[model samples]
Target: MTQFHAYQNRNPASRERYPYLLDIQSDLLGELRTTVVVPLCPADLAENMRLSHLNPSLEIDGRRYVAMTQELAGIERKRLGKTVHDLGSYREQIIASIDFLMSGI
Candidate 1:
């Protein structure tokens, strides 16, 4: 597992709106039992209501998803399941969104 990699959202209750959880925790912290993640929501449902930079548009599984940075959380690594997609290409945006959430820049 690595930063910017997305995994299937294990909780079925929220899966329709957020189908994936993008791991943002650093590789150096891989040993931790809990992994930090941000839910990736359907663009049409989340984008318009989000702040700029705080919610980046991402492509996953041939669809567009909005990174719900404000929903950042840490869950058990085992709950993340297998990696469904690699979001490494959106590294800068992902980092920036987190930065914006922490520092407003």
Candidate 2:
């Protein structure tokens, strides 16, 4: 999968709060066949929190959501559903979110 491509979460149990997940893994690692994803939570829950260092707010399809960078993980390609949004424009913010998650800065 291409980096920064958003995918719809097919897991019904977790879809209500996290309807989308952003793939941060690069295409160069396609051989691994697994995607590293960051779950996106609804704005209401995200905005009321003070974890900006880890959860960065972002807009997807006009609705605001926070990228749960701390929840990053690798999952099988089949676990991801249809493409939801392409987060190419938010590349810098996404990267910064990840950097803060990893480095705490």
Candidate 3:
């Protein structure tokens, strides 16, 4: 049986096409969170998240789920258009969003 089958066998209708790789980051204080999501397999998902020094959340099918925080995960859901050449500036916006969400804005 395939690794995917172990997690997805219960639902044969599931497809790998829409699988998402999510990465989450937070300060040591756990007061800040940032996230990025890409399309990739579970192994690569863990690798990339590790490279970014963040923990990961795993899910199988739409019924079962794992997450650090919905709002933190929601950051990647809102795309920022084309990639920004200036990551410093872009990073500011991301940090601001995290702060806003955490502050209950």
- lDDT of all predictions: 0.91, 0.86, 0.30
Can you give the TM-score per candidate against the true fold? 0.95, 0.91, 0.24
Best by lDDT: 1
Prediction-by-prediction clash tally: 0, 0, 0
- lDDT by residue for model 3 over 1-105, one digit each (tens)? 101111111122322422332233432423333334322234432443332212223334423222222223223322323221222323443344445546745
lDDT of 2 by residue, 32-52 (tens): 868899999998876766386
User: What ranges in model 1 sit over 4 Å off?
Assistant: none
Model 3 misplaced stretches (Cα beyond 4 Å) = 1-70, 74-89
lDDT of 3 at 43: 45
> Which is better, 1 or 3, measured by lDDT?
1
**Ranking, lDDT, top scorer first:** 1, 2, 3
- After superposition, which runs of candidate 2 have C-alpha atoms over 4 Å from their true positions? none
Query: What lDDT does model 1 reach?
Result: 0.91
Which of 1 and 3 is ahead in TM-score?
1
Q: Write down the worst ten-residue block by lDDT for model 3.
A: 1-10
* Cα error of candidate 2 at position 51, Å: 2.7
Pairs that collide in candidate 1 are none
